[model samples]
Target: MKKLLFFIFLLLLFSCKKEIKETLDNNYYKKARICRDSKHSDSAFYYYNLAKNEYLKINDSLGVGNSLVNMALIQTDKGDFYGGIESSFEANKFLRRENDSIFRNRLATNYNNIGLAFHFLKDFEKSSFFYIKTLQYIDLTENKLLCYNNIGDVLISQQKYGLAKIYLEKAYLTQNSTTLSKVINNLAKAKYLDNKNYDPLPEFNRALKIREIQKDSIGLNSSYETLSTYYLDKDKNLSLLFAEKMLTEAIKNNSPDDRITALQRIITLDAKNYLNNFQHFNFINDSLQTARNKAKNQFAIVRYDVDQKNAKNQILIEKNFQQDIGIILLALALAITILWYIKRKKRLEQEKEIEVKNTQLKISKKVHDVVANGIYQVMTKIENQQHFNKDEALDELEFVYEKSRDISYEKTDTQGEEKDFSERISETVSSFKNDEVNTYLAGNDSGIWKHLSSKNKEEVYQIIRELLVNMKKHSKATIVSFRFERENDLIRIFYTDNGIGISGDVIYKNGLSSTVSRIETINGEIIFDTKIEKGLKITISFPAS
Candidate 1:
């Protein structure tokens, strides 16, 4: 008797649990539907997710699929195209093939939403495929028309006009006014695109008439754009008129994309008012980008908050497991701290050794570039000049000594340039010129150096000195040319010589490698041209910002 009583009690408990689960899932789903109908997308998404979890608890595949479909629709509408496609694919896993009309309809909707997401993302091929897939499960005429039109639109984007026209004609059989206008517009566009001689003006006007009569502001914007594009080459006045109308309609409908399209058209056709239209285009484009970024960020935050909330709820349900996890995590944290401390101690020792080695390397490079190169330049001057000035040679030696002293103090070489950087650069380049080598410079105006940073100027000075040093030592050049020009925001320096050029497999020695590093430090680029049969050519470019 006691066993029978205990069995009955267990059955009652299970029955109550099942009833409560079903009620919760049903209530959550209904609330989600209400939120969705009210256009509260974030709230609807949250409730749908909750209902989906409840449905999973009760093993109700249909309920789970329905909730996921709703969530995906919201995501797509909110411009989360990738997230929408992902959710639709997850829902497809639960929605199986069935004889029931409702089940097939749900499956069709899921595929259609995925197609729509792909269409927005501009994956025309995948979009066409999914739209075709949607047609296989779709039964309703209106839905079938939508899928057909979508496939046609995708084909048109892919420039397959003939195939696009066939599906568009099929969709045109629909009596729905909105769908009819959409299909007619696309079909006419496809025709006009396929044959330049084809006059789609009649059909375009017909669609425009319907949209205007129905007071469809969005549809009217599309019509204006189409008409403007059609008359762009034929009649500039008419194109500008239509483009202005489109801009007005777009502003009324609060559509940034249409506004941008209209602005572009206006700017192209109305060259007199180019600046005004271009400014408006820039503002609208920036605002649209910012808004889309904000919406995507909000969607991410909503998903994260929901997941965290669900996790906390689960943790609350398993308090004993939470205590065990906390203890294990604490132990892991302590062990990590001890290991990190030991690693940090070893890292510090290694870093000190590396610092000393780096300092030694820097000193050696400075000695080679400054002191050695300075002495070499003096020797070249004395050897090449018929009447070498002793005072000028002494001044050059003093400059080298000052540089060597500053290298020991780790001071920058860019300071004390109030005398003018351009003059210094010219003096350095001319100092290398003699009877044997004719070094010519062009476009070395002080204006070119105005926008360069001090550090960049210093690096450029060093790079030029290094190149001259390399030429004196390696290349037996007779003629050398240095061209300096400012191309918009970039400063370009061109160096060419008439000597034995480097082979394609030439390796960069210490001097060349240091030049490369200096260019990189200034966010500049260098190219060595070894294809020249005679002399080497190197071009350096950097931003003037």
Candidate 2:
């Protein structure tokens, strides 16, 4: 009796849980449908995601597929073509093989959404491929007409006008529904683009009348633009009138491209005070362009992040089906570890910031000493003598420029500058050379740098220049030597100077600190050795890659 009661209790518990799950899933799905019907795309997407999550909990692949397809429609509507493509592919993957009517409908929707995404991306061949795929699952004449129209549009884009006309005509004959106006418009476009005698104005006007009766402001904007474009060459006055209609409808429908085109037509036809009128349209055009560019960039970034996350999740879920105990524990442990790591990291970051500041201060000092003094002397000479010396003035300015460039470690060998890298390096080295301290540079030629990657050469040049600057500031050497030699796959730089030998407490000054940082970044090795009687000896080695 006890065993039987326990069994009954377990069955009741399981059934109750299943009932609650089903109730919640249906609630979210119903809410999503209501939002979708109301054209609240964002709200619909949010509720659909809730439904998808609920379905995922129940392992209902069909429900999840439906939610994904629905979300993809919103994505495509928002012009996130790549994002829609990804979601549509997921829907197709899960729903394509299901033979039930609902699942088949979902698969058709996925195919259609994929086609729209590719169409927006201007990949007509790929768009046609997916549009054709929907045919096997979609039995609705209206939906089939949409597919035919899309295929025909792709053919028109490819300049296969004759073939396009056939499919478009089929679309026009498929259904006489309220949406058939768009199919007629497609047929007209095909005939007109093909340079045929099929006067598209009649069909375009017919579409305009249908949309007007339907009270679709969005649909009317397209119709108005079409009429304006079709009449632009035939009747200038009629074109201007239609253009005005297009502008009014575009403003009402929030159609930015149509607004821009309408503004251009008005600007052309209405020359008086056109610029004043254009100021408002220009602002609208700029806003639309900025929004589009921002959306595209955000879509790309979000797609990349979501793809990375989903790839990891898919792999983990495929390999493991157990309860998420490990993940939970990992998260808890990570939270604790992050607390201490962040504190330690903050201290280290502060130290690095201080070091960089000190380096910048050192550079400023060098700039003040070498640059300011040179300029002041030039000004003093001119002021005392009361004479203009263009050559001498130019020489002082060049000296100041060279020193400033060295201080900043900037590369002036831009492509348009027509400057040579070897020449730049030689100049850098010669800039430090003086009567008291001579700097010699060897193997800084094309042969040495030709095989090295641009990045590798840049870092190396920077490191060597920093070392030269430090030597000039502190080494007080009579001679400085720099040699670049390649051994096997390694590029070696051997630097020596006959200066006061390295002391025990050699400061990590700005120049030396930056050079060391560069070496570490490249995973290179550096050696420093000094003797009481010998000058500084430093050698660094890295790959030429």
Candidate 3:
């Protein structure tokens, strides 16, 4: 009977422990939801941390990942981009391990959220890369509308308006009741950027209708704000009406960004009728500033709370380790310190090397400015001297010009000045073209030549002059064309001669070696494609400034 009583006691103890755990978990979740709804981010973060710890203790991977994502959202809202990125990455790692399709979709959403955080931080390339990755996974999932809209937003931020419009349109097409308003609003924004002013009204009206039907104050505010701006030129009365509505909703939503945007719009519109709207504009502007200051302070507090919680957790983890283990850790730490010192020294040396390169560039700029300019002036004086022998003076001038050209090339030889180099080449080529060659310069006017360092200008002139000389000597063709354009930050100079084109095999033994050497000196690349009947097409890419 005593043994039976002991078993009953053990059972009760285990059951009570489970009940207590469940109660804590449920209470933490409830508090987190309430805090988030109330915009009490610090309280939400605290509850989230409590829930996350419990989930981690129970080895609940999905629960832990979910809590981490929520914490990341709070971190993002608080403008802690680095912390948010770390949290999102951690969430993604856990979610990836879970094989469920629903969890995989959640992982994609997390990636998109991380991209948004990076976007806010002005890390556009990383934002675009991650958003694209999210889209790839989102395409295979049921949450297509959300994925499309987010991808569109990322593309828009990247200033790829054409691509943004495509994705936004797709989102609009696939959107359901939950996503319709947002998709429509995004579509309207994309359309406005695309310069489709005539059709934006329909899209904005559609989004506004959906927002009104759903009674979404934030969505309604955004739509109203956009409409006010759209109609400001067309209908002042309607614009004022919409602007007032936006201001009211923005205040109700307690969104400082929205309030600022609405006020700024009203101020701009009121400038036409300054006497009537001046008071309203001033009042809104003051309120907007106050709201912004309060939001900034609240964000700071949230960040501090998050940091404190993380510090406490870290301290707990450290305390759980054994004393002997700590001694071993100290030894390991010393070894790591030595290695880190060596790595840091090497890193510093590399940075010094980069500094040296930059110094060289600055020296080059000075040489071009002073030495090259002085040489050119001397050359001009020689050319103008009537008593100077014509052939001898020309020879002296050429020599001086060549030296000036060499100095300019040395100074501006860096990759950043290649586009300027290409434009100078094009101008030189155009100058050399006479009635005989019927030379036509085609391609976009880069205007990059205007900024070329003296050194780059000289090299470009010599290169183009060499090409023209070659064309005149070897090519028996009637027409020659040179085009200058930039593609992917590389300046492309295309030289085509209608004259008799030589085979690449034949050119291997000719002036090709000198040409190749000259291009390689400035880190420029060249491609030559020629047919027996067709003209030789020589394409060269130089680093453009």
Candidate 4:
């Protein structure tokens, strides 16, 4: 079903491609988009500014706005979020009032870019606000669905699982393309996180299959990360496996943030092998720092250039308007503006050359940081670090070499000293006792720890963890209680919370779904009593063994 929808989406996306070129001569705008689609981002950036300069020469506000948007897209993709937002803001001045569908679409895209930048910056509320603004300007059904999915993503970040599902579901049903795979995946997550009984695996697999079919390297990287996050707590080997996949894709795209996340996951999960990966990690860290610093300075320079251009253009416009009151002055003013544009064209060519050279120089520095330092560290380790076994050192050097050519692991220390079952339970409950949720634990120290197997204790811990996650995400509960019961052969637990309970049927969100799955495997039975306004209560019984 999703494949069919995605096929439809491909047609629509391509239709836009055609229309995009049809409206322009074999012009810079068309060329820029073609280059962008083909992943020639540097060329795309250059062409977009060529388009912008052409528009400026004729005072074509709409053309200039579109060029700015295209440039903003390039900047955003390059991780220069602040520069992208600045371009978007400048584009907005020309885009805001135009009712043309194309203009409005640009407006929507600009807002979405702003929202994504803020999201990456961890300002989620502001991000959500911009996404809402995007919705207001969006006109097409396909674009609207994209916004819905994006808004759903924001809601998920806020832990509004139920509400996020509503938006995601709407997008899923209306989507004409497989791009809503993310929406489907997010919907599954909402179900699990809402602590309802749901199987999110099918949707996850479905999304993965779609990305693979599409050959979407970036989206595939995201799929790997998503799968890795889901498995991190459940299966270390599997988590590391997916994180490794993420690392491969991240390297292909030269995405440092993804590299860090993938490497951190691998390191935490594969501590036994950290010594093997140390030199490679140092190389990645140093290279990332260097690349980011260069990008920061480059964006700063671009912003300065843009500000100067806009200020000068405004001055010219004001002069032209004022001098138009006199015929002779107006003629001179027009000639002056024409001459200025001629000079600007030559200046723009020089600036473009400088920009390309600057980027190349930065690349050289990044290479030095990665290769030279990494090789030095590896040599020093082999010669001076005698504690590392010879075979292990050779293996580690090979690992670093592979990484130098391409791309990502981690183990987390326990948050504190490990405690037995009872103490762990107490700490878990108290952990959730923040200002919002007043929580109490009863019968926790009542010999429950003495008779249970470690497996049973772990299962119980996971169940409680899932319960707490549910409460925090969905219940909006202020007061919560946990009661434990023990008998000759059976263990019983009761959990209740005061919050907005299930609105309708309980289709089990993500965390609760897994909890249910685990309990079923243990031959445990659980029941929930929920009312719309009152709250929720759960009762569970499982074997002591």
Please report the candidate that would top lDDT against the real structure: 1
User: With candidate 2 superimposed using the best TM-score fit, by how many Å does residue 508's alpha carbon deviate from the native?
Assistant: 29
Backbone clashes in model 1, listed as residue pairs: none
- Per-residue lDDT of candidate 1, residues 194-307 (tens digit): 999899999999999999898878778878988998898899999999999999988887778789989999999988999998999999999987876766677676666655
The backbone clash count of each candidate, in order, is 0, 0, 8, 21
Per-residue error (Å), model 3, residue 471: 99
Which stretches of candidate 4 lie above 4 Å from their native place?
A: 1-38, 175-177, 196-198, 252-255, 306-321, 324-545
Q: By descending TM-score, how would the candidates be arranged?
A: 4, 1, 2, 3
lDDT (Cα, tens digit) per residue for candidate 2, span 1-545: 01111211222233333333433457888898789789886778777767766666565777777777777777776666787788888767557455666666667667767776787788988977887886777756666666677678778778988989888888877555445776777678878887857788788888888888988675676677678778788888898898899789877767776788789888877778698768967898789768766655654554454433443344235334344766788799999899989999999899877966777678778889988998898888888887778798887886787687776654243221335667767877888987898988888776666677667767776887778878887888989988888866787888999998676566463247778889987779988876547789898998767
Please give the RMSD to the true structure for each candidate, in Å.
Answer: 17.1, 19.4, 22.0, 31.9
**What is the Cα-based lDDT of residue 84 in candidate 2?**
79
Q: Please give the range of 10 consecutive residues that has the lowest summed lDDT in model 4.
A: 407-416
**TM-score for predicted model 2 compared with the true structure:** 0.52
- Candidate 1: C-alpha RMSD after superposition: 17.1
Alpha carbon lDDT at 363, candidate 3: 73
After superposing candidate 3 on the true structure, give the runs of residues whose Cα lies further than 4 Å from its correct spot.
1-34, 37-39, 57-59, 78-83, 96-98, 119-126, 136-142, 195-198, 232-238, 272-545
What would you estimate as the lDDT of candidate 4? 0.72
